[model samples]
Target: MRSIIRILGVARDLWPTYAAIVVASLAVAGTGLLTPFIVKAATDHVVDLTQGNASGIATVVWLAAALLAADLANTVLTNVSGYLGDTMAARLRATLSSRYYAKLLALPQRYYDHELTGTVINRLSRSITSVTGFVNMFANSFFQMILTVVAVLAITAYYSWPLAVLLAVIYPVFLWLTTITSARWQVLEAEKNQDLDVAGGRFAEVIGQIRVVKSFVQERRELEVFDDRYRRTVRTTRTQSRYWHTMDATRRGALNVIFFGIFAIIFVQTARGVFTIGVMVLLIQLVTMARQPVFMMSMVVDSGQRAIAGSRDWFAVMAELGERDELPAPVPPTGRATSAPVEVAFDHVSFGYGDDDAVLRDVSFTIRPGERVALVGESGGGKSTLVSLLLRLYSPDQGQIRIDGTDVASLPLEELRGGIGVVFQEAALFSGTIRENIAYGAPDATPEAVVEAARSAGAHEFVSRIPAGYDAEIGERGLKLSGGQKQRIAVARAMLKGAPVLVLDEATSALDSRSERLVQAGLDRLMAGRTTLIIAHRLSTISSVDRIITLRDGRVDEIGTPDELAASGGIYAELLALQASATTRDLKRLRQFDIRV
Candidate 1:
């Protein structure tokens, strides 16, 4: 009961629609009662009368005409109210969808890591549909049942108040059944919904990484896992369906038997002359009418339970969302004369994803404006983690990160992110034309500026070679282009944004020697007057940077120019020697390949 009220609270803004639906439902019930009364009158006068008098026949005709009029009115009212309810539900769905999307965008990146994308998508789809459908149907059913029950009681009382009182005897039993079945169904629905989430998550995971599965020859293993999950889902649905079917059958069958007994008793009284023919006919019709209202009670309860299960999921998402603080009024970009170009700084920052296992411990670094700094380290050495912090994808557990002395946390997040550009290791690109992809963040950039940026990023030659040139459509994630081509386009996009600071995460590591030269030339031009942080595994990529910082165990191991670090005999020196050895092996392999040919 408490949960139902809470769900209805969400509908406070749509109560006018609810009220209109109520009115139409009452009209339907009133019409149903009139229909039976018309039959009662027609039967008593024409069929039970002596000599079939013309006056009686005319009276029966009038009753039939009245029934037709009532039916028309009921139809119109129902159509109007049904339309209003549908419209209100649509609006509510829109509001909920907008809130869900906004919450996703506002959350920190860590939230995404902990949750599955498919689970979130499935919840948004199913819960919204369930909640809205339940509200609409439940409202109509409740109002119609109330009016029907009242009319039945009035007619039954006219026959014999004692029997009407006897009919009331079954109310407690029906109510008890409604409560128990509803609770059971609610629990079952919740279980089924969770199973769906799991199944969807698994399916999405496998599909997204199908190449990995195939390459490793794990297709049979993955299929077996999926089949197990699917079988569990089917079993759960079967159990729920069985419970619902048994409950519905028992409730409906018991009510019909009780109403039949009432009708038989009334017929006995009519034969004995204790009840008039007209009254007996009305009693029979009203007893039949009682069946629908009683059955409706069960449906209303069932629908309510299903809705509560769905709304609970919906509200969980709403409650768990993080609040985004409103942005301050826009301020024009400052730091002209006194303001330096993009200077990146991290101040005594200690941070972790969730626990005390810090990824960056007391990390402090400052890159002077217009300097190119390279962050190099083994995988999981906190190099990428540090870049994520700079991007404000996650805030530090302690201390602060600043851009040009302004703490990034204090600035509007949009403005802060807009001031810097990054090219990820994977070179993430959406499906779109080359021109559109290059100006993704800068939608208003002119075509000439876009072409110029592409030229500066060494992408113009290859793009021009394509059939559509700059207008060529790249498939999803730029799968249509080579890995090097995608990276070059990513660089061109960053250059087009013209942000003062640039962060490149293994930007050129995937390219061949020729493509690397072209992309390197583009990077040099883009980094000329901007502060740049480069994360690279290849030794050659970072040699030209102003400084190289080697990371070990979440802290800086060495920071110096390339020559200085090479001679320091620290972690940097060892890494350089290992890479040089690998390169020598690769060259020898090429020679062997030529001799074999």
Candidate 2:
């Protein structure tokens, strides 16, 4: 009931439409009361005509006309109710979608790590559809049923109190049946929802790794796994259906048996002269009208339970997410023209996705206004974590990160992020036109400026080769493009933003030799006169930087010029020797392959 009320809270803004629906519903249910009156008039007129009375004929015709008019009004109300339901569903979808996107963007990285992309999609689409059904049918139908019962009881009292009491007794039995059925279904639905989440997660995983699945020749195995999941879903759905069907059969049987017994009692009363023919006919009409409302009310109970469960899940997500407590408002950065771009300093900063073990530990570094520094480290050594910290993607637990001597956390997040451009390791691109993807960082950028940025990043050549040129559509995640092509497009996007600080996290890690050279040249031009921080795995990328910072176990193990660090017998020296050895081994393999061919 609380869940229903919470969902009804959405109607506060649409009360006018809701009020119309309510009034129409009451007016429709009120017509049930007139059913007995119409039957009474017709029955009494027949009795009068047998005594040669023509006066009652006119009254009979009037009552018949009244019944027809009431039926017409009921039909109109039904139409109005349906229209209201549709509008309500549409409104809810819009509200939820807006909130879902906002919440998703604000949620911490830890939240996403445990959630599947497909599950999110399912909740937004299918789960919301179920909620809409629960709201429209369960709420309105149940209210109308209550109104009908009250109206019928009042009319039945004037005809026969004993009959009304008998019918009222059946209400508790129906309520008990519905209560049991709904509780059972609620548990089933919760289980079904969890199963759905697992299924969705599996589908998303398979799609994302289709290439790996094919390469490993495990396509058949993956399909078998998916088939098993589908079978489980089918089994659960069948079980639920069987339970619902049984409940339906039981309710219908009970209503039939009880109504038959009531009719028998009323007939005996009429035959014994305890009630008139008019009164008996009126009793039947009253009882008949009550049947539909009762059945509808039971259905409402069932749907309401499911809806509440679904709503609780959504609210749990909302409560867990809460809201990001960011600054309400903040001043923009004014350090661009202050002799230095902005001195970004990290003081003993440490962070991890979760727990006490930090990914970047006691990591202290500083970049002057226009300094170009390179972060070089082995895998899992925390170079990427540093870039993430600088972008404020995650907050450090131990120390502070300052930009221009102001704590990064103190600045408005939007303003802080707006001053920096980062190209991630994966080089993610959306499904859109080349031009749009490049201009994503700066939405209002002019077409000429977008073209210039693309040219500067060396992406314009390949983009021009596409059928639509700049307007060419990129497939999902830019899967249609080569690795180098995607990286170049990402670079173009960052270049177009033209922020004062730039962080490149292995932006060219996936590209081939020729593409890497081309991208490296573009990056060189982009890095000039800017505070640039580079995270690279390849020794070639770090060789030209002014300073190399080596990370080990989330801390800066060494920091010096590239040659100085290479000469020192430390972590940097070992890394250089390893890279040299790997290069030699690669060349040896290539020569051997040539001789064999």
Candidate 3:
């Protein structure tokens, strides 16, 4: 009940609409009660027809007309309430979805480190569907059931104490039995839902990565895993179903016997001249009315329990900390700030992922304004983590990172991220028009700005060759483009951002030689006059960086100009010697970053 009330609070502005729905449901209940009494009155009037009263015919006719009117009202109000319920449920779904998405966007990157993308998405689907479905049911049927139950109990008790006592006893006992089943049932249901959620999550992931699955020929293995999860659910369902039905059968069986005994009492009393036929008829009708809700009571409890579980999951995510800039909501970037490059400093930073050994221990370095430095290290030596920390993807455990001597923690996330443009090994493009992808955060970017950025990144030629030019729809992640094309578009996007600080994480490492040259040219253009941090392994890519910061076993092993580190025989010289043994390309690409390796 508390969870349901809390859910209602989520859309509290809709309270007036809910109140109107409740009124309509109440009227439906009122009509249901009116018809039963009308039947009783008509039956008694028929009894009077057999006597000396000639007015009984008209009385019966009027009673029948009144019963029809009550039924008509019941139909009309039910339709109106149902329509309201559907619309309210839709509004709630939209409200929940948009808020959930906003929270997801604002969450720290670390939250995604241990969670699957599909699993997070699956949570939203499950939570919204369960909550909205329950809301619809509550407005359409559950409210009416409560009203009907209370009205019938009151009406039944007034005329015949014995039938009322039997009905009252049966109602509570049935309710008690339902409660017991409901408790255990919900516990089992929670477990089943976990299985279902995991299955759903995996299903989406598999579809997204179908190419990987098929290339590895692990289709059979995935199918077996998916099959095994569903098979477990089937076993759980059998146990859950058997228990619920057995209990429900027992409850209904008891109600039926008690109702039969009440029926026997009414017939015996009426035949003995202790009651009238009209009274017996009314008692039967009222009892029948009560039975329907009593039977449906389990379903209501079940739906409520499901909703409670769903709401719990939804609120759990909602309860997590969104990005804490320690300031008011971030103002939007008006336009690119003046590109006066700022010095970036990492001061004695120490950190790791949750419960893991420290990946970076007491590491510190500084990049001067307008200097292009390259970070070089063995794989998993915290090179990527270093850049990530600079991006404020995760906070450092032991030190502050400052840009131009101001602690990054003091800056708004919008400002901190907005000032830095990054291009990674994989060009993570979204499904949208080429122009939209290029101008992602800059909604006000004009077509000319977009084209200029594209031309600067060397994407304009390919984009122009396409039928739709900038209007072309790039499939998910730019799957329609070749590797080089995607990287160029990514460069164009970064160029469009016009950020004063840039980070390049092996931006051309994944491309072929031809593609690498094209992307390298674009990256060179993007890196000019900016404080750039480059993370890469390719000799041609980093040979021109003004300095090299090398890491060994998670500590700063060397930080010097390439020639100085070459003699120092530090990590840089060692990597240079090793990479020098590999394939060679034109020396011209190194001119942009400039190292003497």
Candidate 4:
């Protein structure tokens, strides 16, 4: 009930339309009530004519006209109510969908890690549809059913009070049964919903990683997994369907028996002359009228229960805390001036991903403006975590990080992030033209500036050689491009943004020597004059960095120039020696191959 009220509250903006629907509904019901009376009068006139009453013919014509008028009024009002109901449903759907989408964008990244994409999509789609269905059913069916039931009972009482009393007593029992059945049905619906979510999540997981499945020749394995989940969903759906059909059959059976008994009673009373033929006919029609609401009551209750279940799931997501931007509003940008280099300082910062031990423990470091520093460490030694902190992807558990002498937390989120450009090892590109991808970070950048950035990133030569130049379409994630080409495009995008701070995470680690040379040239140009932080695994790439920060076991093991660290015989020295030895072995193999040739 609370969920239903909340959904209605979301549709509060459309209250005027709802009001119009209500007025139309009432008008239709009023016209409908007069229908049986007109039919009753017309029947009595026919009886009078058979009994040789000469004026009965004119009376019958007038009664037929009245009945036709009432029917016409009912039809018109019902159509008007349906139009208003449809309009209200459309408004509610649009409003709720937009709100949910905004909430999705605002939610913190951590929320997405635990939730499946397919499950979220299903919940969002189902919930909105449920809300709309509930509103339409309530406005068009349930409201009319109530009014029709009440009007029918009143007219029945006007003819015979005992019959009306009997119906009133039976109505409550039917309602009680519907309420209990619907409650059980709602529980089953929740179970079915869970099964569907699991099935959808599994299917989506398989489809997203289809390449891995095909390479491993595990198509059969994936098919079996999906089949298992699908079978479970089918079982749950079948059980729910059986329960629904059983309840429907039970309700109809009960109504049929009660209606038959009432009809028999009316027949006996008429034969005893306790009622006229017209009254008997009217009572029989009213009994049929009463059945409409009783039958529709079950359907209304079923739809209500489904809507309530969906609303609960939908509101739960809406209730989640969104990512808060703690800083004040952004200052307007001053014309096209270049961003100055950023100075960064980490002061006693510590953080953990909801663990007892910190990933970065009391780490302290600083990079002067325009200095290019490389962060080198063994895997899980906090290098990536440090960069993530700089990006404010996660907040520090203990101390603060400062940028340009100001605490980063105090800066507007957009302003803080807008000042940094990142190029990951895998160049993440959306499906779009090359020009669009390059200008993603700076959407309003002029085309000349985009071409200039591409040239500086060493991407212009190849981009111009393509059929459409910068306008060529790149498939999903830029899969159509080679490793080196994708990295160059990514570099071009970052360059176009022209942020003061650049963070490169093993940008060329995956490429071949030739590709690496091409991408390294682009990286060199991108890193020039920027306060750059490079997270490098290959020691050879960072030999020219101004300084190296070596981390070990979540603490700074060493921080010095690469040459200084090499002479100190520290962790950086050990890594350098290992790579050197690997290189020597590779050179020897090359010589042997040359001699053989």
Top-scoring candidate (TM-score): 3
| Model 2 agreement with the true structure over 482-583: per-residue lDDT tens digits | 888999999988888777888988678777777777777878777777788887656677778888887776778888988899899866676666556667
Give the 10-residue window scoring lowest on summed lDDT in candidate 2: 588-597
Angstrom error at residue 367, model 2: 2.1
* Tens digit per residue, CA lDDT, model 3, 404-450: 99999888888888888888868889999999989885767899988
Query: lDDT of each prediction vs. the true structure?
Result: 0.77, 0.76, 0.82, 0.80
For model 4, how does the per-residue alpha-carbon lDDT over 149-246 read when each residue is reduced to its tens digit? 88888888988888888777777888887787777778878887787777677777777777889999999997888788778768877887788778
The count of backbone overlaps in candidate 3 is: 5
TM-score of candidate 3 relative to the true fold: 0.94
Q: Write the per-residue lDDT of candidate 1 for residues 1-597, one digit (tens) a residue.
A: 465566667657777777888887787777777877777777767755564454545776787788789788878877877887788778767766776677777777878878888788888888777777777887777778767777777667776887787677666689887787777777778888888887787778888778789999999998888787778878887998798888878987897788777877898899999887777778877776776677777767767776777777877876764626433334332221223467889898888889658888888888989998988766666888988998888889998898888999988777887777799888999999999999887777789888888887788989999999988999877989998899999988888877778898867766778877888887887777788898865667667888988877777778899989989997657666655666666545323212110
The predicted structure with the larger TM-score, 3 or 4, is 3
Candidates in order: C-alpha RMSD to true structure:
4.5, 4.2, 3.6, 4.4
Worst 10 residues of 3 by lDDT: 586-595
List pairs with backbone clashes in candidate 2. Answer: 361-554
Instruction: For candidate 4, give the lDDT of residue 241.
Output: 79
TM-score of each: 0.88, 0.90, 0.94, 0.90
Q: Which pairs clash in model 4? A: none
lDDT of 2 at 108: 68
Q: Where in model 2 is the C-alpha error above 4 Å?
A: 32-36, 46-52, 55-64, 238-256, 322-340, 583-597
Please report how far candidate 2 places residue 361 from its true position, in Å.
2.4
